[model samples]
Target: MESLRNLPLLDQLKDQSISTLVQTSLIALIGVLLLVKLVQRLRLNLPPGPLPLPIVGNWLQFKEGLNPRNLAELANKYGDVCMLQMGQRKVLVISSPEMAKEVLQTQGVEFGSRARNLVFDMTTGKGSDMVFADYGEHWRKMRRIATIPFFTNKVVQQSRRGWEEEVDLALNDIKEMPGSTTSGVMVNFRLQLMMYNIVYRMMFSRKFSGLHDPLYVKLMTLNLENNRLAQSFKYNYGDYVPSLKPFLKGYLKEVWETNQRRLSFLRDEFLNERKRQTGEKIGVDFFLEAAAKGEISETNVLYLIQNMNVAAIETTLWSSEWGIAELINNPQIQDKIRNELDRVLGKGVPVTEPDIANLPYLQAMVKEILRMHMVIPMLVPHMNLQATKLGKYDIPAGCRVLVNAWGIANNPKYWEKPEVFNPDRFLKEKIEPTGNDFRFIPFGSGRRSCPGSLIALPILGIVLGRIMQRFELLPPPGVDKVDLRSVGGQLSLVLASKPRVVLKPRQI
Candidate 1:
């Protein structure tokens, strides 16, 4: 035993057990080292990020995980562009404006690829999902179909009434209460409005009617705990634990399946409605057009419907929520906006489609809100078809590019006081972001920028205009507006923060 080392490699291994064990152990160690180096190389352009190790990656960097404050703090330390290693993926984060502009605008095609996560695969199959689809024919086709019919300028003109009516209902809902405007209502304004404008219009072409509708009811109620949990679960992965995804693939799958069931229910309803119609093909709604006579498979229809719901639902809703919160916190901005609306529309009159044209201040508020608060902060990752150079880095073909809209939205080079919310900055000179200057990006940019952009503007303008026109949004009794904090799903454009406030109808 004492002279075992001196016996040499061959002699020690002659004891069959030792040789077999030694061979296996050596092979495993080599494999692990090679795998690690491969992963290290995969995390390209290091970009000076915090230390990330094993399965967790840089998720541990923030105790709360990528909150607005955490991002702000990271920028202070690691410049603007930082690569955060999340699980097996290199989450490249840019906290600057110029870099963001380059990624989304000039180098858009090069950087236009989506992160092909397990959730995407499980939900949409082979990256067929529009939001996460590759920047090629399929994505283009799907997007074109959506934009041409539902989101084009003409469609937006058509939707003006829907938008107006929804806002009208909201205004009425607030004022309808005989006893009090802010008493015994107990509703989530953000969630409620999103349903009416986004999900309701996008899917069935109407609003939810009653509590008997389980899916709509379930959707409207905020599951803060589950939403946060689902978010935290996805960001928990790394190269060291490459085979660990299956253990935690519940949320997205469950949601997709739930949506599928809902679509089945919708299909049945549509068929029944068809029976009632005298004699005609399916109506001009998103669903009827996509799967009339079930041309598209039920599964695809389900996926499509579900996708539409989340995208439309969250973007419009979150924008309104944060914008309102911003206004509530900055009463001066609120007062200024109210004055502008009054000057444009006047009191004792419901806002009209023609009236929207004159509301520059309202337009500025929405633009500013989008800039300061990005809906989908980072555009879907843009995939490069061929090799090209961006900045100092010589990017290879097929490398995933993250267009950091978050960084661009708050880039100090383009935006002064980027963090502090201000709408006037948009009014200065010419500030229309036409993919050339990405200083303000709420709905992404380029050919792949959200098709719903046109559809959304009028909807947003109408809702925001009507609400601002009707309500006196006030801070709670003694709470300071300066301390307002925002929170929401990690890595999402959705921001749900600030406690609820009582809204009293003020005379216009």
Candidate 2:
């Protein structure tokens, strides 16, 4: 019996030795293949970049997250158009306004499509949504369908009155908060609720009851989670390095599951409800009508709603917060805007969408906010369909392009005293957010420029203007000024500290 046990143990040792040998052989084969690929890559006359290591090219450089600050430092080292090796992939970081136009506008078509990795592919339903969809006939059709309800001048006109009322309701909510009049209130939470309500009304023809509502809370929670996952540089690292994916399977699975839950909520709660409606018309009726006519698929409709909620809500919420915080910090600027509102619309008069046309200072202030605090600093990444030359640099086909809009805006070469928060700069020179002036492209440009700007501009102006009209904005006690330090690694830049302010209702 002892001999039989010894024989079995010897066989087990032999099996282990064979497994170890096979693993070693496979690794050696892979290393050789990677070396060949590296040699081929070096042979190409690509743009200059730091030396990359095998299998994990330049991945270590962006451990802090590939944010504006990181990209700006790289720009200083390498000229405007610098190449970065993110694993096996090539990325072009365009830091200057001239290069930005060359990629985003001049040759927008060449780099028109978005590059999706494993995560983006699942979240965007294989890039069917307009924002990430490849530049093609399908994308054009989707954009047209979306424009009817979201971007057109008619939609903005129809939604303006509802938006004004929502702002007033939000102001009342803030006023009702305990000690809001004297001790002040944290406006960030309430402000986010208000911004969501504005977009919610536009999308569903109604607003959530308040922040405490169960459905509202659940939706907000899911949206926040989704945004965090989408923007997390650490979470999405596998997208840049394919070899790292086996280790990231669990993380990717969670993200996919979360996105599915978000989509399911939209379908069950919102899309199905719209489909059931007969006598009543809602904001989503246009989409439902198109679905019925087979002009757009049901899946695409659901994703479009998901796109609007995620894309429109948080960015707009933060923009409002930033604008208001800046106003509180610069009380003189706040007073000037209030005096302008009083002059144009009279004291205590609620600002309407059309009133934005007459408020020059308000417009300038908003532009300054956009310039100073770029919401989406690094705009959506673009992909090149073919090898292209950008200013004597040979960019390989399928390389990703990231336009550093924040860097461009803050580059001292373009704007004098770039760090200062002054709206007066715009008063001297005329610039449009239309993305035509590459130096100040907050909304992006070309075929994929943000379509919601027409709606966004008026809504932002109304909310900020009305708040200033009804209240004397002041900073929270003990805090001398608004903290401008941004929390890094978000899809959009967000305030590290949620701004707190006292909204003293004017005695008009």
TM-score of each: 0.79, 0.92
- Model 2, 54-84: lDDT tens digits are 6677878776667887888899988788888
In terms of TM-score, which candidate is strongest? 2
Indicate the residue-level lDDT of 259 in model 1: 40
Distance from true position, residue 111, model 2, in Å? 0.5
lDDT digits (tens) for residues 12-130 of candidate 1: 55788777989999888767856884575676444666767555566565545455456656777887666566544555555666776666667777677665544445545656656
Off by over 4 Å in 2: 1-42
Clashing pairs in 1: 87-237, 87-238, 97-411, 111-382, 112-382, 112-383, 113-381, 113-382, 113-383, 375-493
User: Model 2 clash pairs?
Assistant: none
- For model 2, give the RMSD to the true fold: 3.9
Ten-residue stretch with the least lDDT total in model 1: 178-187
Instruction: List per-prediction Cα lDDT, in the order shown.
Output: 0.61, 0.83
Best by lDDT: 2
Candidate 2: clashing residue pairs, number? 0
